[model samples]
Target: METTDFSQPIRQSAKGIIVIFAFNLVTFVKKFFVLFIAFGVSILRSKSIGNVTPTMMVLAVIGVLLIILIIAILKYLNFKFYLSKDDFHLATGIINKDNTIIPKSKIQNVYIKQNFLQQIINVVSVKIETAGDKKSEIEISALDKPTALLLKKKLFRKASSVSEELEQSESIEEPEVFFKVTPKRLLLEGLSQNHFKSFLLIFTFGFGLYSEFKDFLQELELEKHVEGLVELDEATILNLIITNVIILIGVVLISFLFSVVKTFIINFNLEVVEHQKTIEINKGLFNKVSLSLTPSRIQNLVITTNRVKQYFGLHTIAVKQAMVNVKQQKNFNIVALEKEQLDYLVNKLLSNYNDEQGDVAKPRPYFMRISALEMFLFGVVINGLSLAIFGIEMLWINAVFMPLAALYVYFAYKKAYYRISEDFVTIGSGVIDTTTNILEIHKIQSVKLKQTIFQRPRAIASLVISTASKSVTIPYISKSEAISIYNLLLYKVESQDRDWM
Candidate 1:
């Protein structure tokens, strides 16, 4: 594989760091304000709010200003960046210069962002990401857009070649026009689906109303100072309930509308293109993110089915890759599809492969029953503690909740289980909201077996399989079974001579 050095351009751009200093100045000012607020609040709560001494106030102000100025001066004096043959380097700081090197082979993606100001100035911001950190590998604030893109492409090519060697397989196929969520489907999904944002909005509105009513009641001191501000008659009670119900309905409707608008904007012009060796996803009206990933990078696949969707026999599949930086990785890389479409896509990603036998390991039925017992005990302890904290006012609630809690715990534990197959590992869990994760053998990085005191008596244990970026744990298994899986994984890693990452 061939690589290009980006050292000269990065170094040249780093000199005379006026802009860098200015950015740091703004950051320092923000931090200073935060500190000021915290200090002022602390002092005000303990003593007279308006009795702050002039000396103290002047000293605080001077301290904030000095800190900001010192940071700005350092930034102006010490910022620098350069490119190495296989990596890029950045050095900054006046007193103790910090050096960072990002290997080209680890580069996952590169991005260019330009706001209205950048468009006018003919300069762009460049962000390079690698599988090293959740933050950007390097951020170049101002650069000629064409030159930046050229450099990004050159690095991407080098990274892709190295990744190909690692996979040791021919390039994966990319479809010309892959499946996409259209405007109509997006709208339908939003209205029919129970999205996180929708529930959050509903919760917010309800909580706000409750808080305001509670505050107003406290201020009125109704029981202590009963006044006829608003007559508490039958008409008043009826009106209050009706108004609250109307508000709740409105909240639901508004939540649905917000979801629809968000879905429409995000999936607008959504497209996924597959190349011979990689897949590229492009979409979004604002703050767009373009992600490219090879099939071999995928660590696990999750298929989720909600109650309503389950009734319709529909499921949404999310493809998870082992990118070290979760934030820098792609969203919607896990596309929603019908069952057949989902199966087809999974097959394509997996491709034709030899079915190497997986090490045998199975949790016995008794282990699952024990898991249920543990869950029930946990619920009892938690509710018991809550009752002690809240007193008799909550005693009645706990009495009614006892059985329900036990049942829930029992179901939760009963649902938790795992199975190792010839080429993959499957874990199923959840009581009210069940989910099964399917992970390929090659995707696993490490396997751990653990035994608790109670589990030791029963010869039961737990297994945690770690991927490049995520971990899935099986709560209850036999100790012997856990050992078998761990040993197999150790053997595979050593034989391959490649880090799980």
Candidate 2:
């Protein structure tokens, strides 16, 4: 088990201070330019005469620039950051001083970044993100590399100390190994997925290229002077078809090459390493990327297997965790793993489930039927009349509402086909793109039970579980089933101390 001490203050080096000042100075100049130009434009447009005197405009611009410069200087002076035994403090604001404190325990993630300019200056940017508020994250930009590293270590120690103080049962042991795609595995999986998607991509690319370049190709006028006597009557049309096909082929080949190159480059130099309580992945080619995640931070787990992978007895699984302020959910993927490996991974992560747990789930039998009265009223009274008013030529297509009406019945049947256990809910649906969404009880945030008159007679209801990006919906389930799941989710959310997303 790993242990850390939290009672330490953060400090920056002399180089860090200079680099920060330089960065702020550049930012200040840029802001000044924008403000000065905006003021100048306003003054010019609001002049008494159609054209304002150049002298007044120049002086006005200078005055605005001077104010901006002064503000920038004051802002730089006002900004300050300090770390204490159990919290971090930041204060800023030129005219009105503002101070904010973030407890060590509240820090969700600390971001470290460096750009080309920052590298030259031997500085890095550190952003402290929290789970409490969306816009309240604090940033300490352009600090010396050593200072940034020190800050990161300090935060890590603080978090570790807190975990220890909380007396959590789980010992903070270092991970055995960070899982990464081996070169052979990467090649195999990349090629497999590439081949699977290639046909669709080729067709789409070829068609789009033809559509875009048709006029240009035709405008070349080379076809008119063709010497070949392939066809006399339908020569022009044949030539057009041939030209389009050639362009399509070229486009497909080029797209395929591009995909291959991109895949290789992206998966190049991939590395994964785990320290106590944290898994870090560093990868990418030109624009290197790094992702750090902790198991306690996980919000949801998603495992997906494409038809090809399934056919080949392989599976790809991803574990997702919520990251504050980050647009994308942070995910770790295990690609092309065999059934045994996948099972081992899953068992390790969710140790609460037994081997026979998945099979023990039973399908809820309450059936919900869509209200016939509501459907009839909507079809004839609402949609039917609207189409008539709009002068739809093929009104019979609308008049025959079996296709849409059939959906109601099938969805109900599909919902009946699935089952839910105490620990997890499994929803199975879709015909061509068959999918099963398995959500753990602990991952559910808020449960919403929705029903309309259209659904009352059908006895069908929809349950939406609030997640990080979008709510997961289990639709056309029996009212009983919906309520059962809803209650279960509610109990889990209330009982668990972890925040949902």
Candidate 3:
């Protein structure tokens, strides 16, 4: 193990001052946007009233920049981090000092990222995330690439060594490169993205732009002229339809282009490598990101594909990690894989990958019965409400949906299934877009079985399997079956010596 001198505090790269200043400025603006706007307006008013000259305004800007620079310098001076054999320690803050010590075992992920600025400076930001924290426990804004890589390797080594000691075993298997996203595959993935989502995004952006334009026109007292130029009432019905068609085509094109560009940028040169104990992912274009995670840390795995992607024989895999009360979103998802590759990756990455070979268990016949009854009741209530609010005519209109509701219920009941194996449990559900959630049995935090008053009469129960991050439920199963699965999961949780992150 590489030993570092702990007597001296390890400071960030000199480029960190610039990064800190920018970060502080962004924080200041975000926290007090109204204040910033008010300040700007006041300055403009003063200048217009001849109370402040252009030179004075320039001086004010320079003064603010100087103050920010001094604050950044102070922060840089105060901020320091050093790694001990067992723990990583950080000391930060200028006025309110904070000293944090995080044990090696608690560290769930270590990420190195570089934004455009940091990339230009040849420095990367390091984020050390703990198991339960929403944000990184420690963040080094700027570190040389080599230093960051060394620190990451050291921390991971310390963590792995401790685990090996506890288990009294070590695996010397060579790391394998599982998958890499080529430019063509990336383009396919981008094209396969949900068009509805892209359309909505484009619609929102267009609406916002239109609103801003309207506001600008109103400010300039040219609203009437703008309205005259695009008179809606003067257009014929045919002209209106043609115009709308053209607009819709334009919007869809823009949305598609934006989605393709964004996806390409985000997933550029994506690569996935797997070691005996961990999986590492590297990707991104403008802002490069590298992440490492152990299989034990994964709460569940979701493999998703739409009709188009299915036709293309591609799937996107996402792993959910144990995040207790973490509000921040993590971008650890991977995209564009063939079924064979997906199976290979799963087999190599998950300890319980063979669980899929086990017999799949579908919900009992009572599930369909209960679903039908529920749908009928729901329809009755909806029709009743419609009748009360808008008379018999509305009730008749809603009555048309009663059969559709029943069909939906039947499909849902048919799709719901759960399977358990020695080491993992898989829950499969969804109607239009199917989803299968695979979770390691040892990682299950809790298993809940509940029977409603209506369900109890039929001896049917709902089972909820929960992890640190999310819960998966299998509804309308036989009460006895639910109990058996729950007990088995509990046993796995108790008996397994495996660490869940």
Candidate 4:
């Protein structure tokens, strides 16, 4: 394998034209979906004035594809990148020329990925991220695997000699596998994952879609199909219960399917590989992604699990790194790790990391009172909405939620604790699921004391600890305790000679 000189500008493989054209076509289709749906509806609404031939529709789509293909070709022609002494320069733009230069030292990460389309075309995508940008600043979508690897190395200046580069390119050794997830484990993880979000998403999408097509359905007299649903209003209590149970089961099953399919697809054949200086991830089915992580660059480690998962000895750990923007923060989740595997990974990431839940300090009982009040107000809002929207008959819905709220408040107050140690600060929290966030004291970016007017009356304050990854809040604690924690964090951070990044 011959390595290309970095000094020379390089263009993406010609196949980039196809990928770019496909992307634009997809975007155009998504944007004009309503128009397409309306056109279909108009055709379906009447059959007499339907001289709109199928040939015309096919030609219209072809015309759109041709236009997008031309644009993609022009865009591909203008895209080229090269490496300078201490910077990576990219020149791109179709209508107006644009140039971007990124300092090599500022390069945060370089990831190589291949989607289904790219895999078919036998090209990989190389994305270069930096400290200032929320997303990758440079993306080359059509590069051979070797070229992508070479470019990644050059961005990080990993190879010092041409011989080493050529040797690396020619004979690459596979990294040792740290962990490999089995399909059964994936299925269990999918089952154990919290599906509340998925349920809400499916429910919301279904409602919105129904609303969108309600008028069309009415025009087609399709309401007659579901008119049987109204009979439930006049049913016996037992029948109502049975019907409700059936609906609940169907929703839960749908949500579980969505979650399971998503989990399997995203983590298909997942493998964590250990490299000399970094840990790498290789996963995804249709879209293959490979990411490298330097342990020293990690900001925090979060371990999350729930009672259901605990029964099966399963835990999920999130690896968080320093990033300027929260939205752009690169957090990797490795699910379904056993206790021993979790310990091994944690110790490897944080040298000598202790799992001792040292003398923990619980938040003041004022926190409990606060939670109760919030839940009470939430109940009132729910009942009020039920009354306003569905009449007084649906107010019983609040009763069903009251017990859940009480349970949440109980566990929330019970789980809230903070432990400050010589090297780490652990924040324990969550309701049904338990989340343990451990951050090295030296990685603390800043500490803040926040107090609300209500909290001031109780002499309680919150400690907001900010790290490069995200902020953690320990709320409803005594003002004095908050100050002590704040001072200890600052002292530890100031005394450290090591950099967080």
Query: Evaluated with lDDT, which candidate comes out highest?
Result: 4
lDDT of 4 by residue, 1-501 (tens): 988777888788899998898888889999999999888677667632357665677787788888999999999999999999788899999879989888877777787888899999999998877756464557788888998888886776632223566557434766689999999999999998899999999888867897899899676655643664665654555675897798778888999999999989888888888865567877888988877776766788899999999988889988887763553242277888899999988888888778674668999998889899999998889889888878989977867898899898999999899888778888999987899999888888889999999888889999999988878988888999899888878887887776877
For each candidate, C-alpha RMSD in Å? 6.8, 8.5, 5.6, 4.9
Show where candidate 1 strays beyond 4 Å. Answer: 1-26, 35-85, 89-101, 111-125, 133-136, 142-149, 162-177, 188-215, 218-240, 243-270, 309-323, 329-335, 352-417, 431-434, 496-501
For residues 1-501, write the lDDT of model 1, one tens digit per residue: 233346563442332244454466667667678876877777767653466765677787788667766675566456566666677777865778778777877766566655344545556667777666565467776666566666765666666665545344333332465666666655665565665567687777777887879877787666533554456577666877998899778877888888777766665556666655566666565544445655666777676655655555445666676564554444544434566766666666666422343343345666657655676687677668767877657657666666766666666666666767655777777655557677777678778887887668888878888887678887767777678878876676566664333
Q: Write the per-residue lDDT of candidate 3 for residues 67-127, one digit (tens) a residue.
A: 9899999999998988888899999999999999888877877889998888888899998
- On TM-score, the stronger of 1 and 3 is 3
List runs of model 2 lying over 4 Å from the truth: 1-79, 92-98, 114-124, 143-150, 160-176, 187-218, 221-242, 249-268, 310-318, 330-349, 353-419, 426-438, 468-470, 492-501
Question: lDDT scores for all predictions?
Answer: 0.64, 0.60, 0.79, 0.82
Off by over 4 Å in 4: 1-4, 32-64, 157-174, 204-241, 324-331, 389-399
Q: Find the candidate with the highest TM-score and give its number.
A: 4
Ranking by TM-score: 4, 3, 1, 2
Worst 10 residues of 4 by lDDT: 322-331
TM-score of each: 0.68, 0.63, 0.81, 0.85
Model 3: which ten-residue window has the lowest total lDDT? Answer: 322-331
TM-score of 4: 0.85
- Write down the TM-score for model 1: 0.68
> Comparing candidate 2 with candidate 4, which one achieves the higher TM-score?
4
- Residue-level lDDT of model 2, residues 1-501, one tens digit each, is 223222343334334545555555677668688875776677667753456676776776577656655665556566777778788888887678889888877777676655555656666677777776677777776565566656776775677564554334333454455456666665555554544266567777766896899898676655654643454758777877998899768766665666556555565555556554465655555433445655556555555555555666556655655545444243255455677766665655554644445533323333323334445666676566757665666467554675665565455455334455666665555332334455566667678998878778867788777655235666666788778777867887788775543
